[model samples]
Target: MSEKNHQGKRTARQRLAVEREKQKASERRRRTLIVAATVVCVLGLAAVIGLLAANSGKSSKSSTGPVVAPSGAQGKDSLAIPVGQDGAKSTLTVWEDFRCPACKAFEAVYRPTLRELTGSGKLRVEYHLVRLIDGNLGGTGSLRAANAAACAQDAGKFPAYHDVLFENQPAETDDAYADNNKLVQLAGKVSGLDTPAFTKCVKDGTHDGWVDKSHQAFQAGGFSGTPTVLLNGKDILKDRTMTPAKLKQMVEAADKG
Candidate 1:
């Protein structure tokens, strides 16, 4: 071959090599851009998903709307439903859940003594409703019953209705109180308690926020369980030897003091 032709062919091959390298570099840049875009999209989608999850968690954990305390409710934030004379000398604070079997047991044992003391104006009871069972058992019975009790409180029959609930409490795992109709039917046992307004309050969940707030406070207080009975800021049930007679004696002593 002629020397000029051979040199021409060599030059042509060099140009081809340079062109192939430029195309390879271009392809690499395009692939890098696609990978970067995919990562950004995935990160953005992850961020949106995280935001939704956070909002859902907040909605489930926090109470919504205004807390409507029961009529005649007294105490910090009006979370307590008072059941006796305000001028009574001693205060009995009861943290309880209606669906709790232990609470029903406590009420069954102490109701007589409490009634007697409160009747004589020697003791006042501050009942704080909680929904611990609802949280533990995956049902709304505790919340519904507490709200119904608050409704009865509004009707000025809290003490009577409270006793009725405990006396007729269903099994702990029954979750029967979740039915508003059943609660209203039970109200029929209390004379002058099953009014239209009371029914509406029970069914509409009027005091749900107040009950939830009280439950939150109970949780924050680090209490271990339900039917937490306190007398003048002392945990009476912790004594393990506490009885109705003992509770009466303590209240009388406080009154005398």
Candidate 2:
């Protein structure tokens, strides 16, 4: 072969080698980028899952330990705290969350009427406490408050203490009731509720599991929200015109029936 031709062929081979090397390097860079992006996505998804799991743990943990129903708790699974004579002709079932503002509002409006009817042996109230706000607002206030109320039930002072809780309910976003001391202090407002046993029960979360079970029952009932008020198995709040007077009239009608 001529020297010039040999030189040209060798130069062409060298150039092709360089091009191949460049292409391989480019492919390596692309693969590295793809791998790095995949890793970031995986880590992000893991973080989200971990956060969700942590929240679930907090909620579920509140209900851990024993399911001790309060003394004299009635209804299915002893979930309902009964007020007034069981033989009353009319029954009102109230599913309430202590941390829920709507529950507080309902209590504010209907408390007097409930007291009157219950005292007269015309209506009985079956109160089911739940920890809904703990799940939604990320706190233990609802659970703590419900457990404390159960303690009052154990003391035979549920009605007075229950009214006190609603009367002194904190803002929806405020978790003041989560503090055991706060609950005990509020118990002082009840005539004879702040005994040593009551304090211990509130601090120890004696009825947490019961409250959790009540909440689960609330969920299973497919109700929309808190302060679910039912009269004689009919949802009363669904009536747009519902008021304390309407409730009284309905209970009177049920009593007559």
Candidate 3:
């Protein structure tokens, strides 16, 4: 073969080899991208499964039937009394569980706005204590605390005792049984409460039936969670994200209606 032809053939072979190497590099990159995408999808699915599991554990069954207010044997208008009043045309009632962290958070965030509205007569706020966490958080202790607050209400000390309980909620993982002494201490902190009577009521479960009645009322009202607020007998806020700003907007809209 001519030297020129031979040299040209060698060059052609080198060029083909370089092209093959380029093709292999492209294939490797494509495979890497596929694996990366598959891993991301798997991670995303796992995250979704975890979220669903968490929510399922917390979800409660909501009642779809008509709501029945508490019986007159308890008291007339017992379900509708204003725990706090600003004489606003609208009434905002909240159903809460003392052991619920979300209820504590809602109280912390909305107390100021609630005080502003109710104190100024622009709103009337009533709180109904529910016992959702009785089994998990503090069983009897949780129920006892709620019942104690009811006794305070009987003695017209609801607001003070209510504030104290939320302010001093035990650590999240602290069992509800740990709250008994603290609840008694809180009752004592509320001036004007019949301390001895309140103590006896809590210890002897004087208000246990009342607490159960309140929970029944909450279930009747279609609530399945703490911090459920009813604005003027109409269900309004149910989500934990119902912030003060959102509540204020709700009140304003209700006023317009």
- lDDT against the true structure, per candidate, is 0.80, 0.81, 0.62
> Candidate 2 regions off by >4 Å?
1-63
Clashing pairs in 3: 86-121, 87-121, 88-121, 137-176, 138-176
RMSD of each: 28.4, 24.9, 19.2
Q: What is the lDDT of residue 57 in candidate 2?
A: 45
TM-score of each: 0.76, 0.76, 0.62
lDDT string, candidate 1, 53-172, tens digits = 677646544463468999999899899998778998899999988877767767766788999999999999999998877765558888999999999989999888888888888877
What's model 1's overall lDDT? Answer: 0.80
